[model samples]
Structures are given as C-alpha cells and as structure tokens.
Target: MERLTIDDMKSIELEIMDEIDRVCQAHGVQYFLGYGSLLGAVRHGGFIPWDDDMGIIMMRDQYELLMANFNEWRTTERFKLVSYRDKSSIYQFAKIVDTTTVIFENFVGKKAATGVWVDVFPLEHFSEQQGPALLKQHQRTGLLRSFAVADPSVGTNAFVKLVKRIVCPFVKNKDLYELAERLDRIALRMNAADSASTLVIDVLGEGKLEKMFSKDLLEPIRIPFEDREYFAPSGFEEYLSIQYGDWRTPPAENARPVHVMEAYRL
Candidate 1:
C-alpha cells in the first residue's frame, strides 16, 4: 500500500465531494460547504494552504432524503456512506468515505483510524422561545462528544493528558453512547417546526455557541472551490462572522494549529 501525501488526501476528498454534488443534484438536496470548508471557500479561493478534507451540510429532511438514496445515486464503487446508524461509527453524523485508503488522526487511538472521508453534517433547528433551555441541551451533546474520543493522546500537553486520565475511569464509553441514543430520541420526539431562526449541528466540540449559524443562511449561493463552483450559505459574510470573528486574516505560522494525518492505501 502506498502512503499518501497531503495533495493525494485532498484529491481523494475532492473526488468524494464531486460524488456528493452529483447525488445531491440528482435528489434536489440543497447542501452547502460547512465549517472549515466554508471558511476556506470564503477566505481562500479553495482550501486553506494547510487544510485537508471537506464538509457539506443539509437540513434534517434534506439530509435524510440524500442518505436514503445515496447508494443508488453513487456511480462509484470506491466510496460509501457511513453514519451513526453503523455499529462501528463513533460519530452522530454521516461520512462519505473512500474505501481504498485509510488515515490516522492524531486525536484518536490507532484502532480508530479510518478511511479518508468527508463529513456530512445534519443541521437541526433551534427554537427562539426555548433558546436558553435548548442551548444547555446542545452543550451536553458536546460534552458527550468530547468524551467519546477522550484519551491521553487527545492533547499535546502532559498536564491535559493527566486530567483526561483522572476523568477517564468514571465515564464508561457504552454508558455515554447509550445517553447519546436517548438524546437522539429526545430530539426526535421534540422535533420542532423548520421555522427556527438558528441552526446548529450535534457536535459543537470547542466553541459551543459560536458554532451556530442563522437560519437565514439556508438559502444557497454558488461559490468557487478548487477548480469548480459549489454551494455556499447565502449570507456567508454574516454566517462566517458568527463562526470566526476575523476570518479574513490568516493565522500566523507560529500560531497555526497542527493538523496530523497519516494516510496509506489499503
């Protein structure tokens, strides 16, 4: 198996994204570049110089429709979709993964390393009337999500590692997973009308509140990414501002976060 360079990783991600575009187009599913992918499209013409991978998100109904028929819409045998529904999946969201290659992430144990994939996030509604109450619920999901991948290897510093070790014993992985299932059920039961003003994903790891965006951004606008055009949030300027305070300025070399990935053909 050949080891892959960052360029090779990006190429695989682009291939997956292209397939996603085809499927979404065929199903009339509206998705927009999300998280870093969105930031990259607006800040750089394509991916950030050091960035790899891509993300696309859709509203709950649109997401369901896309995934329900994704297998039939896909033209390639090399890529497949995996979601929380899969027993082996640790994430609550879906991923379009390349079966041909694998990648090791710094934050997880070696056994958790997975095939190169693009994250497919599902956007859920947040109510205006129950804003404070809903936010606390969202925060709990972040806490559980953090613990799902917790270990000494999670952080670069020894002090942080020690802290994780202290908390590791009391938290059982299966119990947390069961809690997640319950929360997902709660979300399903309390499902609100799609008219909420704010939208958020399930896992808001670090910046909990800052990760949310306005519902007004739901309307799609085409933007340039790599060599082709892709959909972006209509109110991207406002959407990005809510996510990153000064997104236009690139991070300093010394301050830039390290992204560790080791890829190889399977």
Candidate 2:
C-alpha cells in the first residue's frame, strides 16, 4: 500500500465528506461528522494536521440507506467501493479505493498525494452516563461478546481482532458505532509507538489487553437513527485504558489531538 502525505489525505477526506454530506442531506437523515472528522471540525476547523482519514456516523437504518445510495453513485461515477473483507482483515477498519483514480491518480507521485478513503461507522446507544465510565465497562467484558457475535471474518485485521476479543459481548452494533472514535485513540497511540506494529494485539507484551477483555461490563441503550432504532453498548473507565490506553488527560498545546476532530465536539 502507498503512504499519503498530510495534504493528500486532507483533500481525500474533504472530497469524500462532501459526497457523504450530499447523500445524507438528500435522504433527510441526521448525519454527524463524527470521530476524527468531527474532531477536525472542532479543533482545526477542517482536517486534523496529522490525520490521514475521515469517519462519519449515522444510525444503522440511515447508514444502510446512505450506503445503498452511495453505491449507486459509485456505479454512476465509475468509482469503486472497496470492501475490507475482500481486501484483507486488517482493512476491516475501513474501505479504500482499489486503484488510483480522481485525486489519487492525479496526485500520484506528488509530494502530498494520499490513498483515497472514507469510513462509515454506526453509532449505537449508550446511557446518558459519563463517557469515561461507559468506555471502561465495555472494554472489560460486554464488548467481547458483541465482537464474538459479529461476522466471523471481522478480525482478519489483527487490531480489529484484538478489539473483538476485548469488547465483543457488551458492545452492541450501536455501541460499536459510537465507540469507534474512542477506540481510535488507542489505535493512534499504538501507531505512535510503532507504525508497523498492530496496536490491538502487538502492544500487549503480556496478555494484558486481551485479559482485560474478559471482564463483564454492559450498559445497553436503544437509540434512534434514520427511520429505525437499535441497541448500542458501552462500559466504564478501565475499558477505556484497555481499549484506548490513557486518554484521560487533556492534550497539551503541542500534543497531537487523539482524533483531530475531537476538539470540535464542544
């Protein structure tokens, strides 16, 4: 795979977000620029400085509709829909363009061109509880079961596999949606430590991260998304560390934002 420079990734992120916004707006579904995307809007008012991707969340039903419509757009425009399951398990975290086209092809060999990309996450329900507490409980136990029940091939990506092992049961489809941004923090930290290593599984010198997955923490919520609703899972603080490492502290001025968009939430 080719590595993208900061500027290249930013352009891809905005282009995809524009396409996504168009579809969501036409459908009348409530779509939030979420995860790092949201953080980018908040902190940098655009793309995060070091970020290389974009993410968005909608309720399951809306997301389903959005994807269906997006597929039509893909066929009409001659763009490809990259499926992680087909590419590699590691790619499960997102879908990317199979070949350079559009900005990718145009920018190839350029100083800042990047792989074209986008990710859609489904936000589940979490009680009105504080964020940290909810994060912990999920990481401890319930999230594991959720992952186990997830499609058999989800973990083809090592980091995703580790995430499944930890938060499967307690993590419902909805919870996984909302929790994606949070877990991304952990992934980013892992990336910082070693770009080549798998943060979810490889970071654990012992079975610590995996062992943390065995605990039981579940708080389910039924929330509305698009025309329908679904259950989302969540947990507590311990789960946060296990899944995301230490995100408890606020970032320093020079510190890189965990999810570039996170700062914009407020």
Candidate 3:
C-alpha cells in the first residue's frame, strides 16, 4: 500500500466499486451507491473530484454473505473490511479501523491524521412489526428531524440499530448527514457506545474513516492536499449556516478542518 493522493484515492474508489459490483452480482445481493458515491453520480456523474470514500447498502443477510466470502474478496486488491463492532469501547469517543488506511498511513510515513478510506453502510429496512413506523416515515419528512431525533427510552440499543438498518435508505446526503449527527448526540448523551459505534459503523464500516464527533455540528469542506479537489459531507453547502454560522464561507481562521490520517496503532 502507498499513501494515496486524491488521484490515487479516486482510482482506488473505482476498483472497490467494481469489486463490490462483481461480488453482489454473483451473490444475487442487491446494493445501491450511497453517500458521496451516489451524490457523485447525481451531481458530477462520477465522484466529486475531491471525494475519497465509497459506501453501499445491502440487507443484513446480504452483508452476512459478503462477510462470509470476505476472504475471497480480500485478494481482489489488498483491502480490508473495517468495522467498529470489532472494537467499541467506553474509553474512546470513537475509532475507525482501516486495513488500507492504516497501511497507507504507514507507507506514507506521515503524521497527519488521515480519514481516507471506504465505508459500507448496511441498509436495514423496517416494517411496522419491527420498528416505529412514524420514525421510519419521518425520514421523508424533514431531513433535520429525521436525522437528529432519537428515542432515549429504547434501552437495549437494538432499537436504534434497527432504525439505522431501516431508515438510511430513504434519506438524501443532507438527510443522511443529519441522521448521523442526531445518532452521535444520542450516543454521547446516553454513553451508549454500543449503539453509537454501531451507528458510526454504518458510515465507515469498510475501512474508510469519517468523523462522528458532535452530531450537532456539521463537518467542514476539506481539501486534503495540494492540487487535489475539495470534498465535503454531501450538501455541506446547505448546512453551513447552522453548522458554522452564516452560510457564506467563513474566514480560514474561523473554520474547522477535517481530519485525515494519522500513522499510529490503536
């Protein structure tokens, strides 16, 4: 593995997409482009030149099948599947596991924190029998409410997981984002690392690292390196007002920067 520049990252993104497509096609598992990948298709007819992650949706059964054959897929290109389920702790607010990102960081021998990696979000569809129909329906209502609202009464954490499994598909990039923020807030408040990590897992499950710090705050637009393009959470421009103040781009001094990769062991 080598340190991936934006160009290198994009090239890798295509290869990963092809691998997922091939595997899903072979298994009869249905998947859809998610997050930046889907947004790219809609906004740029491809990846946002600066975007560096990839995500997809599949039912739990399909995810099981994919995990079962993960070893076979590993040979496709030296990639690794990273999931927080494997490592959730009360000690840390959050963590991202990246087979490729960790390797890339080491190869580059750089000290900067790097979040460059791919994420696979599992899509869990819900029916009235399984989850609150209103919450599921709320996804289509307002993006903000759909994302930030959480039911604190559900104690097992199973309920929230069920919500994520079901509701993520119906939302847009903006909505997807709002949902992430809301979940993060609930997790932090309840100290429910299990549920919180599971939620974050959806965003960066397969080795890519994206932040899930404050669910209330929106992530900033990021330009990882010189000559590379800029990327932000989907529809970042729309939420800039509430997140960073006035919608107009802020001065560099007032803006927060997106964290990338940091070469170190957990």
Could you tell me how far off, in angstroms, the CA of residue 109 lies in candidate 1 after the best superposition?
Answer: 2.4
* Model 1 stretches with alpha carbons more than 4 Å out: 172-207
- Give the winner by lDDT: 1 or 3: 1
List per-prediction Cα lDDT, in the order shown. 0.72, 0.41, 0.40
Candidate 1 C-alpha lDDT tens digits along 1-266: 89998889988898999898887888798999987899998888888878878888777778778768787788987888875555435555668889898888876656456689998876666544554465577567656656556655567788878877776556535454455454554344323633444665433222254566767777898899989888888988887777778888998999876677789988
Report the lDDT tens digits of candidate 3 across residue range 1-266: 44456666566556655555566567665555545554555455566555555665443445656655654654454454443333221111122224354422321222123343445544332221322333333333334433323222222367765765465444323333334444433323322223322322232122112222222222323333222333334444332332234434334643433324333222
Which candidate would rank higher by TM-score, 1 or 2? 1
lDDT of 2 by residue, 135-225 (tens): 4543543344335336433444688767655654443344333343344343334334433321223111111334233113324333332
Best by lDDT: 1
The residue-level lDDT of candidate 2 at 85 comes to 29
Candidate topping TM-score: 1
Q: Model 1, residue 263: what's the lDDT?
A: 90
State the lDDT at 159 in candidate 1.
84
Q: State the TM-score for model 2.
A: 0.42
Please report, as a residue range, the 10-residue window in candidate 2 with the lowest summed lDDT. 198-207
